[model samples]
Target: MVYQETVAAIKQLVRDGVVPGVNYAFIDQKDVTRGLFGAEQLIPGYEPLKPNQLYDVASLTKVVGTTNVILQLITEKRLALTDKVSDFLPEWQDQRVTIRHLLTHTSGITGYIPHRDKLSAAQLHDALLTMHVGENFEVKMVYSDVNFIFLGWIAEAILGQPIQTLIQKRVLDPLRMTHSTFQPEDPTRCVPTEVSPTRGLIRGVVHDPKAFVLKNHCGSAGLFSTLDDLIRFEQAMLFNTGQPIATHWLTELTRDQTPLGKQWRSLAWALLPTQLPVAHNCIWHSGYTGTFLVLDQTTQQGMVFLSNRVHPHAPNEAFLARRNAIINTYLAEKTVSSKTE
Candidate 1:
């Protein structure tokens, strides 16, 4: 199969020091193709990557975890897109930020805040509220972790529970995503990320500094998951017409909400680059730890590629180019097959 060949390419890439390891799965709505290649750890010792191993999926938490929870709350009438930040937390009442703005990353909130060292997880929400809203707040889309940071807090405030609990009860449990979670119970089954100067050889624990400081569960980042669980998530997202989330809302969530050329963003999903094969109807997102997800609503197809590209140290710029090349390879094959049929 083409996926096998692509998986081989990934294996070769790992062998050639392009990355430490890769655990990938692709869903075409009918069946799944998954593979694990290279050593999960290569510094102190060599350990084979396993099919069920979890990875710190970093910012993917925005879509697969946080977005799922927000969508469910919206569906249940517990939250509205128009709900203002001031409504949930009193400090930001005049900020004029909405739930929709946060999801779409159009709130002009700073992309990141360096408060992890100073504030405890419990204090992040208030600290976030006090952060300066950019001058052009809500005027243009700027991808921001702060956006989902607040959303996580808003969900907690409304549900009267922690974000992790809500994710477990509402999102992961129902989908039977047994291995997907914020704080993984088993550290051994997860692939190691960066060997940070401060943290040393990181494994199982989240790689995002902000999330690590937030007790291993945060809105913007901090989720560990396997390819199987992620495939289940892609299936639900593509075929949720009558499932846990309503069809209408799912459609709205994936469809472009931002103005054209303004960094196309759906409710939470970013529009696929039109230059990519079959991406016109696609939405995708990636994690900071070299993980990526792409779904084509037109064909009910999706791909998840997870990697520990920053094993010994953080990457400077090449990881994204490598990621896109692999994704484009898969999509290119799919495109060719489509034309012949």
Candidate 2:
């Protein structure tokens, strides 16, 4: 089976100590291509991971959760991609950066602010109001988390609710994702992340320090979800559900809008160009903390891999390289099949 082959390729890498645990799911329109195959809790000797276990989604939050909220605001006409971000956060006015630049990571904002340790969400918002954007960088797609952190505030202002609440009412509840959320607070249905000297055996809590500062409600890195829930989110996007977002904004969200060396990134995802010459309509996004997903809209298909792969250790690029190779190979197969048919 192609699914089995793909699973094996990922498993082979995991077996070689490439990643600690990987909970993956695939969705192909009516087929609902969902399955999980991987080890779990790679801390020396723990019981194997269950299919329902959760993992930190990391920057995948930027693509799935944060980007979705932005699109929701666009549909409501509360925001515009071309609208200047400073209109919402007037401190950003001096820079004259627009929402598109923020979404595409071209706002020339610095990568991070260590505000997590010292600010309440309201305090943090106030801090952001007073802080200044750096002047030394070029305006381009820099892929920073701070951009989305600010967008989260806009989501709150536009929707009149916190980001977590917006995600619940707008996203998770809409998709019936019962088990996914700002986890950790609900410890009964959560899994552990990393064991650290400061925070030993951290279970059901966010591993990201910035998010930790928001009390795990930060927009950039606070989501905890199962592989199955992620597949459902991908399904919604691939189907392009009309009730949630305008058709064009959804396309804008997934469209390849930036030139990233070889691949172009869309609003919150990466576009695997036709020149990858494999898939005609392929876009993907990967999480920093050992999670990855790809969406092939042309095929109405998606794949997700969720893992605490960096547990007790950091991630290696091998999984990413292999994943791309596998995805490209699948695209190649489809290409060949098309010719034969």
Candidate 3:
């Protein structure tokens, strides 16, 4: 019944036209519950959404896929958070940027650029390497995709393999996250994103133009996954099975590294310090295509909310208020019960 209220809230939002379709799951350690609501396809035909449907997961890839690869590399002693960007890419040799700056989004790199149409793959790489950094690049956590994109390049350079392969070997395979991948082998099973004029009904392929132009294998974006796979991943972060990454490193990943903001981010995560008496800490990240994951490591509880919110139309902003409301409601209940006991 705890999850049912959240499910009903989602259904009400879908009915109110806030989002087209949503597939969400809540995991409290071993206990798990999920729900699917609304139409997965509302344009050409009406198709009911399914629990196993794949979502673009937009920028969520930065954390769930890309960040995990970087963490694994660090755990293996193959990379260091303090390693300079120029060390791996010679073009960046002049800039004093480090892996930590990239991970924390303080590299002074721009958030996004129209590189897909403006530059070739090689040219794009060069542009990213030569892009301007803030005068105080080491301090500001600007939250940019350029940081993760460059990190993806480093993963390939260090592993002598493509980023997708590195992710499969180091993350997906190790965690048994078989349902998640950079490119979904079965396109039909994927929930379609926005019907862009250039890309049409985006399905299976990445929704991010830069990642799509880069052949759907970038670190910043370009991942597809279901709620269940992400639930498993949350468990990995909480339990630290020690298969994909070390427990010490896992704890480090969530530790605040930047003092730039009131709610500073961790290595690749956005920390949400709650004033709620029930839960004191909540770290989360979201994607452009209407997906987000949140965890309360203190309680070993988390949830993944996946939706095709961009379908049929592109919004100026996401329903972040609704997202916060859901988390707040979910955690408040747990907190109240614990206090009552």
Q: TM-score for each prediction?
A: 0.91, 0.85, 0.92
Off by over 4 Å in 1: 111-115, 241-244, 259-262, 273-279
Error of 2 at 188 (Å): 6.0
RMSD for each model, in Å, please? 2.5, 3.3, 2.3
lDDT of 2 at 230: 79
* lDDT (10s digit) by residue, model 1, range 80-189: 98888879878775657788888888777653556456677667756777776676566688888878878887888898887767777877888898888777777888
Clashes of each: 0, 2, 0
Question: Which residue runs does candidate 2 get wrong by more than 4 Å?
Answer: 111-139, 185-188, 241-243, 258-263, 275-279, 315-320, 333-341
- Model 2: ten consecutive residues of lowest lDDT: 254-263
Candidate 2: lDDT of 161?
78
Top-TM-score structure, candidate number: 3
Summed over model 1, clashes come to 0
Residues 138-194 of candidate 3 have per-residue lDDT tens digits of 666687788898899988888888786777777888888888888788888999988
